[model samples]
Target: MMELDPAATFRQEAADLLDSLETVLLDLGQTPADRDLIDAAFRALHTIKGSGAMFGFDRVAAFTHDFETAFDLIRKGKIDANHDIVTVSLSARDYIRALIEAPDATDPIIGEAIVEELQRLIGRGDAKGAAGAAAPPAAAAGASLASGQGGWRITLAFEEQILRNGANPLALLDDLRELGPCTVLPDLARLPALADLDPESCLIGWTVTLAADCPREAIEDVFMFVRDEMRLAIAPLAEGVPDVRPGFTLDMAEAAAEPAAPRPEALSAETASHPLPGKAAPAPAGAELNRRAEDKGSTVRVQAERLDELMDRVGELVIAQARLSQLAHSGTDLAIKAIAEEIERLASGLRDSTMGVRMVPMGSLFGRFRRLVHDLSRDLGKPVDFVTVGEDTEMDKTMIERLADPLVHLIRNAIDHGIESREARASTSKSATGRIELSARYVGAQVLVTVQDDGAGLDTARIRAKAEEQGLVQPGATLSEQEIHQFLFHPGFSTARTISALSGRGVGMDVVKRTIEAMRGAIDLTTIPGHGSSVTLRLPLTLAIIDGLLIRVGEGRYIIPLSAVEECIELTAADEARSRGRSFLSVRGELVPFLRLRELFDAQGAADPHQKVIVTAIGGTRIGLVVDQIIGSHQTVIKSLSKLHADVTMFSGATILGDGTAALILDVAQLVSLGQGRADDRTPEAA
Candidate 1:
C-alpha cells in the first residue's frame, strides 16, 4: 500500500470544499436572507480553515479566518447576506482557493484587498444597525441563560475520529475562554496506551465548569464544527456548587467523571453491541463515527493513474479471455469450452464493473460552469439565467474532463454571439434576460450534451459572406443552412466584423470541434434566424471499452460500434449494379447513402458475392458501410492508434480480435460524413 501524503489529501479536500463554497455563495446571492445558506457557508469556511491549518496551509487558514468570521456574523444575523457581501465573499473564496492551489505564486496583497473590500461592505451593514439591530445568536442565547445560574456545567465526549475530521480540541477550549471566565477539566480516562495509540485519533474527552455569563448556545456554538461527531451536554450549575478546580469533593469528582448523557437518536447496531467502556453511548450523533467508518470502507479515493492502470490490466485480461475462448471453440473438448465460456462471462462482468467505476455524473462538469456563467453575466452585462437538465446523466470520466473546454467554448459563443443585449432583445420583443440552457441526456448508447441560447441565432447570410471572403466556398456556391453553419467551425472563420477578447479570432469553435472529435464524438449545430441556436455534442459513453460489431472487408476486419449500428442487410449484386455509380440505397423509401469499405481501403481481393451493408446512425445522419463478411458482436477493448496513424481518420482506434489479430475500429462519424459528402456530390439524376 502506498502511504498517503497529508498535504495532498488536504489539497483535494480543500478543492472540493472550495467548489461547494462557491456553489453556496452563488445560492446565497439569490436567497440573501436564507438562514440555512448562511450557516452552510460558515461551516464550509470553518472546515477549510481548520483543515488548512492542520495540514500546514498556514496562509490559507489565516486568510480564511476573516472569511469565516464574515459568514459567522451572517449566521448570527449581525450582517445581512446581501448582493455586495456575496460578491466580495465570492472573491474572497477565490483568493482562498488560490492560496491552497498555488500559494507560492499568490500575492498576499490581493487577499488583503479582497478582505478590505469585505470589511467595507460589512461596515456599511453595521451602519444600518446590522439588519434592523437584531440581537446576535450568542447574545440571545446569553439573555436566556442569564435568567438562570450565571455559570454552566458542560460535558464533551468527542468521537475518536474527531481529529481526523480537522477539529482541534485546544482551539475549542480557547474559543470557550473568549466568551468569559472558564475552567476546563481534561478527561484522560479514555486515553489509549502510547504503544497502541494512533496519533491521528482523539481519545481524550473534556469536562468543563464555566463561570462565564455567556449563553448555553454560545458554548454549544464553540463545538459547532464537531458537534455531529461528539457528545455534548449542558446544564446550569447548581447554586453553591464547589469550584472543583481546587479541591474536588467526592460528589463533585463523581459528577465530573460521569459520561455524557446519550442523545435521543438511535445508535447503529455495531455501536450498540460494542459500547466503549466508561464512555457514553453514541446515539445518532455518536453514530456518525460508525457511519464514517462504513462510508470510508464503501468509497475510497483512488488515484486516476491507478484507475487507468487497473483498466489496462482489465483490457489485457479481456484480450486473453477472448484468445482462450477462440482456442476452446476451435477444439472439440466440451470441458475446455465450458471453462472458456465461464471465463468469458467473468471477464465480461469485470469489464462492465471497471467501466462503471470510470463513469461519473455530468453534474460535476455542469457545476463548474455555473460560476463561469455567473462571472460572464456580470462581465458582459448580459443578464442570462443559466439552466441545466439531466444533470444525473453519466459518462466516462475522461470524456467528461475533455468535454469541459469544448462546452466552455460553446457556452461562451452562445452568450457572446448568440445572445442579444438587453436593449437589442427589447427591440425584438424578447425578454430582456436571455436564457442559456446546458443539458445532457442519454440518446441510445451515446450522451447528447447541448448548449442552447434564446437570442438572435446564427446569421446565415453573414456566415455565407464570410465564407466567400475566406474562399472557403465558391463565390456563388449553393449551400444548405447546416452547410453554412458548418463553416462557423472552420479555423479563422468568423462573421464578427471586429475581434474581442471572448471571440472573433474564429478560434474557439474549431478547437471545440477538434477536441470533441478527438474523443470520438461529433457536433451538430441547429439554429433559427431570429429565435435561437442549439449546439449538441454526441459522445460515446466510454472511450475505454465498447460493444462492437466485427466485420470483414476483404482480408481486413473492422469493428463498428454496436451502439451506432441500426441494422445490417445483404447487399446483392443486383443492388450494387443498379446504383449506377451513385452510393445511395433506398432503405424503406429513404435514400440512405452507403460506403463500400473495400473501395475505401483498396482491398486486393475481389468483392464477396454475399456482401453485407451495416447501416449506422451518427449525429442524426444514417449511413451504410458495405463489407465482405459479418463477424458478429465483440467486447472491444479500445486501444488508441499511434501518432503515425493519427491522420488516418477512417478509423477511430483499433481492437484485438479473438484470434489474436488486430482489427481497426471504424470511425462511424467520419464514415457517415464521407457517405453524405459522396451523396451531395452526385448529379441530380444519380441522386
Candidate 2:
C-alpha cells in the first residue's frame, strides 16, 4: 500500500486550477461574450477556493472568494465581462496563487492598491467597497437555511483492495461531517471472522446520512481522493424526513407488527423491491454513465521529462533492432528472416509513434507574441499588426521549447529597430500600420520557421561602414551584400546610436545565431532596399534521431543527414585532376563547391582513386563533400560532444554505428560556408 500525501495532491491540483484559469482568461479576451468561457473560469476559481480552504490555505481561500464573487456576477449576467474586469481578475488570480504559496509575503500597500483597482473595475465607487460589510440578519438566516437545509443519504463501498491504496473510509466520513452533520454506520456484513481476516484488505463498508445544504459536488469531493477505487451512491432524503438521520434505526413498525411466516421466494422479492432502511439504492442505469462520460474527456498531463525518457528508450530499441536485423541478414534460415522482418516492421512503427508523441503544434509558441506585440506597440507608439501563418505546423516539442526565447528576441528586434516611425514610413510611402509575419512549414524532412517584417530593411551601406569601424572588415574592403548583412549577427555589433530595453543593445542577435547553430540548425537572412527583411530558421525534425547518409572520408566516417542530401556522383581521376586548387566541380555545367572531408578532418588514410561526391544544399547554395566510400543509410541517434570538444564547429555532433564505430555528423551550413570561401579564394578574379 502506498500512502498518499494530501498536502502535495492539493498543491498539484491548485497549480492545474491556476493554469486552467489563465487559459480561460486568455480565451475570454478573444471572445468576451462567451458564456462557456466565463463558466469555466468561475468553476476553476470555485474549485480552487473550496480545495484551498479544505487543505488549510485559508488566506488563499479568502482572497480568491472576492474574485470568485466578481466572476459569479459576470456568469449570472449581473455585470458584463469587460476587459478591465478581466484584467483585474487576472491580477487577483496571481495574488491568490502567491497567497497560497507564500501567505506571509503579502504586502498591505500592494494589497490595498489591488483592492482599489478591483473596486474601481467593479464600479463600486470608493474605498468603502474594500471594507468588510455585513448583511441583514434575516438575509443571513435565509442564506444559512438555504445552505444546510437538506439531508443526503450516501452509501460508500470500496473494493477489497482499497486499503492497498492507503485510504481510510472513516477519514472521508469525518470530512463529510465538516459540511454540516453526518451520521456514519459501518457495515460488517463483508468483514471476515477475526481468525481469517486479512489486515491489508478493506473488510468494511459504510452508510452515511449527511444533513447539509451544500451542493452534491461538495459531498463527492470528500471522496475524490479514493474515487477511482471506491463505489459511491448518493441520494437526497425524501421531502420532510428529519427523523431519518444516518444512525442505526430499525423501523419500529416492521419490528412490532411483522412476525408473520415468510415464504423464502416472496421474502426475497420484497427485499429486492424495497432496500433495507438507511441502505443506498442499487446501481442505476446512469450510475456508471458519468464515469464513462468523463473517461471520454479525460487526458493525462505528463511532464516533459517523462516524454524525453520514453524517447531515450525508443532510441535504444531502434539500436537493438538494427543489431538484430544485421544478424538476421547473415543467416540462411527462412523462419529467422521472416521473424526478423516482422520485428523490423514493429520497431519502425514504434519509432514513428514515439516521434509523434514528441511533436507539438507551434501555436503555443505563437500565442505569446500576441501579448508581446500588444505591449510593444503601445510602448513605442507604433501601429503594428503581427500576423502568423502555418501555426498548425508541428515540430519536436523539445525544439519548440528551445525556440521560444530566440523567437522573442527576433520579434522584439523587428518591432524596436526594424520598423521605422510612422513619419518615416509615410515619407517612404508605406502603410502606417507595419506588419510582421511569422510563418512555419515543413521543408523536406526539416521544419522551416520564418519571421518577416514589413519595415525598413537592413541598410547594406551602413552595415559595411559599421563593420569597417568595428574592424570586422578591412579598410576599403569591397564586400558583397551578403557579407555586409551577415555583420548584423556579429557579437556586440549594432547600428543603433542609442540603446533601449527591447533591443538596440546588440546583445541578442548573436545569441540567437549561436543558439540556432547549437541546435544543429541554420539561419539565413534576405532583404530588399525598400521592402522588409525575412529571417528563416531551418532545423531537423528531431534532435534524438535522424536518417543519416553514412560515408567515409579516408578512414574516418561522417554522417550527412539524409534530409539534406540531394544526390551523389562519382568523381573520376579526370574530374578530380581538373579541379585542383579550386574546389568547384562542373556537374552538367553547374558550378558546385567541393570539399575534401579527408583534408578537413585530417584523416590518416590515403584518399581512394575512385571517390564519390555527395552534393547537398543549404538555402540556395549547393556544396559537395568528397568521401572514400558510401556506407549507405543509417538511423543515427545523436549524442552531443563533451564540453571539451564544444569549440569544434565543423562536426555538429556524433552518433554510434551499429558496429560500434563513431561517426561525426556534418554541420552542412558551416561546411558550405567554408567550401564557398575556399572556392572564392582560388578564383582568378578574387586574386
Candidate 3:
C-alpha cells in the first residue's frame, strides 16, 4: 500500500544495469570478438542512459551517452573490444554509477577523462562524431528504393501503462532524430475524449518518416527500453507501406470501461514484442503482449527495508506465539490450547516463508567479485584465473552483505601474499598463470565458503619466528600447526618482509577473523608447505531465526544453536570422576574436550551430580558443553547484546524464552576455542 520513490527506484534499477555492464565488459576482455557480448554491453548501456534521462539524472544520461556511443562502434565491428577498451569501459561504468548515486560528490572532469580515454581506445577523437558515424553502411552510397531516398517508416505504440513505468515516448523520438531527419505525426484515432482521459496514461501513438540513411538496427536501438512494453514496426519508407497502425487496437477508454482482461495486440508486419531490439521476433504481437503481461504479474519488487521490517514483525509473532503456548500448556483450557496450537502452526509457516524471502542466491554476490578480480589481476600484473563454484547456493541476504568485506580482504591477501609471481612460479615448476578458486557449499546447516589459492603456501617458520619475536609466544614453546596459524589473525601480525599497496601493514586477516566471528561464524585456515592455502568460512544460512536447543546450566537458561549441536549425552558419576582433573570426555572412543558452563558463568549452585554434555562440532573439532538440564527444542529469534556486554565472547546474542525471560545464546566458536585452550593445558608438552 506504500508508494515507491521514483528516484530511489531509478537508482536501484541503474545499479543492476551497471553490474550487468561490468560483467559484460569483463567477459569481453576474454572474448573480444564475440558480437553477442558487444551487443549485450551496448543494450545495458542504452537502457541505463534512457532510464537515467527519464529519472532526471542528467549527468548520468550525458555521461552514459558517450559510453553508449563507444560501445555502439564495437557492436558494428568497427572497433575491437580489446583489454584497453574494456578497462576504460569498466571505469566509465563506475563513473556513471557514481554520477547516479552521488552526483554532488562526483567530479565532471573524471567523467570527461574516462570518455576521452574510451574514445582514444576505440580510435575516435570525437565522441559525438563516432555516434553519428553509426549509420547504415548503405547510407554512404545513396538513398534506398523504398522512399526514393535512404530512409525508413517507423511506427511506435506503447502500452497505456508505459508512462507509469517511467518511460517517455518523446525521448525515443529525440533519440531517433539524432540519427537523421525525422517527420513525426501523431495517430489520434485511438485518443479518448477529454472527459474520459487519465492524465497518467498514454494513448496516442506516433508514425515517423525518418529520412536518415541508417540501418534498421539503429532505429530499433532507440526503443531499447520499451521493446517489450510496446508495439513497434519498421520498414523502408515507400508509398502504400503496410500500415502497422493497428498497434492501437486496445483503446484505453474501452480497457477502463470493461471488465479487466489480458490486453490484446494486432498483428502487423514487424509488429511484435521482442526481448531486445534487432532479435528475431519469437511470437505474434498478441501472444507477445500476453507474455509480457504474465511476466509483469509474476514478480514484485519490494524494498529491502520493507523485508527487514517484515522479518522483525515475524520474529515478534514467534515470541508471542511461544508465550501463548506456555499459557495454554499451564492452564487446562482445551479450547485455548487448540487456538494456541493453531497459532503456533501459522507462526511457524510465516517464519519459514519470511526467511525464504530473505534468502538470495550467492551468485549475485559472487558475480561482483569477477570485476574485482579482473581489476586486481591487471593492477598486480598477475595473470590470475579466478574461478567460483556453487554459485547457486543461497544464503541470508544480511549474511551475504556482511561477508563481502571479509571475503574481499581474504582474496586480496591471497593474490598479494599467497600467489607467487610468474617468474617465481616458473622456477618452481608451477603454472605460469596462478589460480584462485572461491567455492561455497552446504556442510550440515552451515555454508562453507572457501577461498583457495594455488601458490607458495604460508611460511610456517616465518610466522613462528615473528610471533616469538613479538613475545606472543614463549621462545621454546611447542605449538601445533593450527596454533601457529592462529598467530596470523593476531592484531598487527604480518610476516611480509616489506609493505606494498596491496597488503602488509599488518591488517586484513585479523579483521576477517573478527568479522566472521561477529556473525556467529568460524574461520578455518589450512596450508601445505608448497602446494596452496585455503581459508574456509563456516557461517549459518540465516542469522535472523534459528532452531535452538534450550538448556539450563544453573538458574540461568541458555540457547545453543541447534545447527551446531551434534548430540547430547549424560555425564555419569563414573565419567565425571575419571576426568575430574581435566575437561576431556570419552565419546565413542574419541577424547572430546568439554567446557563446564557452570564454572564459566560462576553459577551460584552446587554442581549437579548428573550433568549433561552437549557435543558440538566447530571447524572440524568436537567440543562438549556441560549443562545441568536439557530443555526441548525452541525457535530462537536472536537479539544482539547491548554495547555494555559487547565484549563478552561466551554469548553471541540473546533470545526470549516462553515465559518472556531473556536467555543468552551460546557462542559456539568461543566455547570451542576455550575448550581447545583447556585441552592444550592438559597436554604433556605444555607441562
lDDT of 1 by residue, 1-687 (tens): 776677887787777778888999898888899887887787778777766776788898888888787877776566778888888888988898888888999999999899899888888777555455566687766555442367777766666766665567888887677666788888777667889988887777677778865545566656654555665667667642321111111123333456442222222332445444433322221222234468457566688998899999999999999999999999999999999999999988998999899999999999999888888888899999999999999998989889999999989988999899999999999998999999999988889999999989988888998899989989888788888889988998888778988887999999998898777788889998899999999898999998999898888888998988999999877677767768777787677889889989999878888989999987678999999999899999999999999789989899998788999999887888788888778833533
lDDT score for residue 302 of model 1: 81
Q: How would you encode candidate 2's per-residue C-alpha lDDT over 307-406 as one tens digit per residue?
A: 9999989888887787777878888988988888898899899999989989998887887677677668868989888888988999889899889988
The window of 10 residues in a row where model 1 has the poorest summed lDDT is 242-251
Better of 1 and 3 by lDDT: 3
Candidate 3, pairs of clashing residues: 143-150, 144-149, 144-150
TM-score for each predicted model, relative to the true structure: 0.87, 0.73, 0.87
| Candidate 1: clashing pairs of residues | none
Cα distance off (Å), candidate 2, residue 56: 3.4
User: By how many angstroms RMSD does model 3 differ from the true structure?
Assistant: 6.2
Shift of residue 144 alpha carbon in model 2, Å: 21
* Clashes within 3 Å, all models in order: 0, 2, 3
Q: Which pairs, if any, clash in model 2?
A: 147-213, 148-213
